[model samples]
Target chain A: MSLVKTIKELKEEIKRMSYGKDISIGFVPTMGYLHEGHISLIKKAKLENDIVVVSVFVNPTQFGPNEDFESYPRDIERDYNLSISGGADIVFNPNVDEMYPDGASTFVNVKGDITNKLCGKSRPTHFEGVTTVVSKLFNIVKPTNAYFGQKDAQQVAVIQKMVRDLFFDINIVSCPIVREEDGLAMSSRNVYLNEEERNQALILSKSLFKARDMFLDGERDANVLRKFIIDNINTKELANIDYVDIVDAKTLENVETINSKAIIALAVKFGKTRLIDNIYLEV
Target chain B: MSLVKTIKELKEEIKRMSYGKDISIGFVPTMGYLHEGHISLIKKAKLENDIVVVSVFVNPTQFGPNEDFESYPRDIERDYNLSISGGADIVFNPNVDEMYPDGASTFVNVKGDITNKLCGKSRPTHFEGVTTVVSKLFNIVKPTNAYFGQKDAQQVAVIQKMVRDLFFDINIVSCPIVREEDGLAMSSRNVYLNEEERNQALILSKSLFKARDMFLDGERDANVLRKFIIDNINTKELANIDYVDIVDAKTLENVETINSKAIIALAVKFGKTRLIDNIYLEV
Candidate 1:
């Protein structure tokens, strides 16, 4: 396994590995804090591709002015071990200056109604930064298949749309989100929560599960599902509701009635820390 | 020479050509209606790379609602002959559907100052379309180096900026403009003018050449050069001036006095046909 830090060195390594051969390159991009969710994505990529590359980048562009960009978290040695064990041939850990060099002015955007719903409402310019960095990664990595976790289902949708609309010749493999035994979604930010806050945060997924059970038991009204989830989260101590939406899974548009596939997504704040969770509902 | 009309066939052919070889592919993308200018670009690419592919696409997104998109010239057969003669090994000619699949919602944009100058001022949404399509083409073709004519100098700058920003590992080669014996810059749109209009259109180039000569003879005042070019174009009957700008060649900013490299560019209309010409100056 080769670890590279610069794009030029990474490109050379990828070239050496892929030269004169038809190697299927798989890529898993993350923000340096490796968890079970990220490992699941890496394992999925490893199983499917001849060569696997994992990138650890804490992209500052995706965070808003008030977002937790400065204190996101980083553990290079832990991540390196986890990634190698999870089956990554190359670990690409580029610095901020390398990923976004001086005078980087171009951006790839998915316009219209797609970016205005769900998580996008709070983080307005978030997806633009996501699409831009992903585009750059796609170009630099030139992967045959790319892995993304379903924990960020909206991000999966945005990236899939970006690839399709931009005509990128790569497959997007969306892996299921890994979670703890208590059913809380596996997230790097979970460490920020105190023990009490951590237990309270489980209510996010617990509430979504309750709503899903209700959904499976003949409840189809979007407003009913949204209100039920919101009410459940409101009862938990130290839990403040951010938003609860029942939206079309594909378009991310709020649906009045759940006649088709939809995502029951929400965000909740546990004091200083904010966490997001969702469940896919299908008729 | 392979002539492909579908993206799939083209991709397969390019892949086959690229497999098991250390080959450098050079690309020339253009709206069909090939002339000596486009041929010059093809010839330049042919000389520099191991394989050459020229794309003939009339991109509609770059055209404004009132612009001449419907009337844009296209001659596939003539273009094929010229491209083969001009040293293009493959001509990837895709339809509108192949280039821009249905529900294409992604776009690449260079914001701030670059897109607001020169032809961009007249066609506001032009460079976005150019970057989007060119980005798509770059991905589809996977060229080592891409060629563009300096006739569209601002486009060259925009594309160069996009390539650098997006981290595309392809070199951009800007070829010099090919001109007629009468000093008129060659353009596919040149066919829109009649004989009288064509004769008067020479003033566009004639004034640019006059300014270049004066600059060589120690004229450095930008205002004076702009006024001189404007006056020379104004004297011709049936020619309506659009704009004359003396701008820094690199930044495309207007200069008070020509202390460094500059581009003295102008646009003029003869009848319903708009013609553009420019001259590069350096101290």
Candidate 2:
């Protein structure tokens, strides 16, 4: 296992590893501070591919003006230990300069419906940033299969759309969301929550799980499920609802009557720490 | 020497060809009419790489509403023969539907100063389309080295910027502009010119060459060179000038006085056919 920093070095290592062999590479792209969610992806990658590469880049472009870009967590030593234990062959942790040099003006933008809803409503520039950095990483690490977490359900959809649209010859394997034992979805930003806020954050997953139960118990109307989740989240005095949308799983378009696969996704803020969670409703 | 139409087939062929060996693939992306410029690119690719893949795609997104996308000349048979003679291993000519399937909305855009000037002023969405399709092609082909012509100087600059910005890892080899014996730059659209229009189109290259000679003879003022080319093109009664400006070669920003390397690029119309030409001024 090797932890590389520069693009040149990473490429050299990859070339050395796959010199004469037709090796399959599984890439897990993350923002470092690896948790169970990322480790699960790495473990799955290790199982499937001959080599597994995990990219730990906290892309600055994804954060908004008031967003916690500065306050975003970083613990490379711990991340390295976690990645090694999780079976990551390569941990690529490049600095801001290495990834984005001066005058880097090119952007990969996914316009229209799929990108305009959900997290994109308030964070306009987020997906563009994600797609651009992902493109750069994809080019650098030409993996056979790339792993993503279903915790960011919309991100997976957006990335899947980008891969299909742009003809990226790699399978996007979306791993299930890893959560805490108390039903709170795991997030790096969860560190920002105080003890009380951490307890309040449970409302996100708790509401979604309850809504899932309602959905499974024959609740067909989209508005009813949305109201249940929204009202449930609103009950916690500290939690402020950003959006509670029940949309078609594939297209991310709002579903009126859930006859097919749909995702009940939402975002809420506990103090300054914003958290997101979702549950799929399939018939 | 096979002409593959589908992406799956092409990928399979490429995999078979480079199954266990470290072989370089050179890509020449063209719109197919089999001109000298394209042949030059293929010839260069053949010289440098073990496998050469030529893609003949008449990208619709690059052409604007009033542009000549529908009337664009295409002869796949001639293109195949040309590719064969040029030592191309495979000719990839996927249809528009194959390249851009349903719900393809992602676009790679190189924003700001570089793309805004030159041809971008008249055709706003032109560079976005070019970048998007090229990115898709790059993803599909995954060529070690991609060849381009310097005739579209701005395009070469834009693509180079995109590659660097996005970390595309493929070397963009810019071949010199191949011109007719009479010095008119060779283009697929040259076929669109009527006999009379063809005769008048020479003024573009003639003026550019004259400006080059003047620059070589110590003319530094950009406005003087601009006026000379504009005035020279105006001498032809049928020629309508679109733009005549001298700018830095790499940045594409207008150069007031040519101190270092610069490009005197211009666009003009003969009847319904619009033409472009440029000459590099290097100290």
Candidate 3:
């Protein structure tokens, strides 16, 4: 497996690959601290295309002023090894200067209620950064298909909306969320939690499961389902609920009664770490 | 010359050509009523790229309710012939439905002060539409370079900003505006004017030329230059002045005095037809 570090080199490599007969490129984009969740996306890309390229760059634009951009974990050597083991054809690791040069002024906003709700409420500029960087990577990789994990549900939705809206010719394949044995969703931020905070973070997924149970048992009231999850999180001594709401799955708007598809999403603060989890429920 | 009226056929044909080639595609996006101005853009694209694709879409989202979207003239056959004549490799003429299918709920917005001044004021949604459709076209064509005419100065600026902010890897090439012998800037909306209004429309460009003359004669006061242009437009018997102002060339903010690079722009109403023109000056 080859490791590429510069955008020019990557573009040149991708350009050379495009000349090879019948070569299909697949891409998986992520920030450096790779895990099973990222591996799942890479694996899916590997299965689907003739060549798979994984990009690991900690994008600065996606994090808000108060967000954990500085503390975001990085293990480039380990990530490179894992990407090669997962059958990635190439790993693109661009430095900050390459991805974002001086006087970079453009931004891509996916506009609408979905971007204004959920995680958007706190991290206002998050989706814009994701869309902008992904667009850049798409051009550099020139992939036939790109893989994204469903762990960041809103990010996936926002990207899907952007691709469709912008008429992107590349296919966006979404992989299911990868989780630990105890049902905690795997995230790069998971590394930030201390032992006690990590244990308290489990409640996020548990609350999502509890909401799923309520839906499975034919409870359709969105308010009641949200309250159940919120109350459960409140019971945890270390957990502080940021937001708990049941919204339309597609539009991401708060729904009074769940009639069709709804997503129960929540973000909680465990000590100083912020964790988010959600469950999609269809009635 | 072959014609492609559907996106699927265009995509299929592009895919076939792109299968084993490192071809650099150049895109020229337009609202088709092909004229010398649009042909100039297409010609420039042909000179720069290995594969040149031209899309003729009269995007509806960019037009305001009081604007002339419904009455916008279109002649697809003429446009197709002209595109082929202009050396475009592929002419994508998608219908409204093909570009925007039912239940489409996505939009790309290029934000900041660049979108808050000049043409952005009268046509609030204009830049948004341009950014969205151009973004869509960029994705669809996956071009190595995209061409725009400087006739739409603010639009070229907005798109340049969008490309930078979004991290699109394609080069943005700005071609000179194609003008008539009398120096009236070419535009599709020129078709809406009657002979009398057409004669009066020349004043729009004349005013900008007047400002240029002032700059050449060593007049550097932006407010004075702007007032001179507005006064010139006001003197035209059939023309109603909309806005005449001098602004910073890059940011499009009003300038008190012209120091380095500045743009003098105006919009004038000749009966029902609205005409716009601009001139960039460096002191």
Root-mean-square deviation of each candidate, in angstroms? 2.1, 1.4, 3.5
Cα lDDT of model 1 by residue, A148-267, tens digit:
988888899899988887778999998887899999999999989999999888888888899999999999898998888888888887998778888888888889999999998888
lDDT of 2 at A52: 91
Question: Alpha carbon lDDT of residue A188, candidate 2?
Answer: 86
Candidate 2 chain A: minimum summed lDDT over ten consecutive residues — where?
Answer: A13-22
Q: Which model is ahead, 1 or 2, in terms of DockQ? A: 2
TM-score of 3: 0.86
Give me the candidate number with maximum TM-score: 2
lDDT of 3 by residue, A1-283 (tens): 7788987778767766657565789999999799999888888888889888999999998999988788889888999999988879788998888887765656777777889888898888899889888887886777889999876778888887777777876888878778899989988888778998888788888878878987899888888888888888888899988888788766677899889877787888888888888888877
Query: Given candidate 2, what's the lDDT at residue A233?
Result: 81
Tens digits of lDDT, candidate 3, B1-283 = 4568777788777877777567888888999998899999888888888777889889998999888888999998899889988999888988878777765656666676788677888889888888877887787777888888887878988888777756677799888778899988889998888998888788778878878998999999988888888777888798888788888877777888788788887788899988888888977
After superposition, the stretches of candidate 1 with alpha carbons farther than 4 Å from their true spots are A18-20, B16-22, B257-260
Q: What lDDT does model 2 reach?
A: 0.92
True contacts kept of each: 0.91, 0.99, 0.66
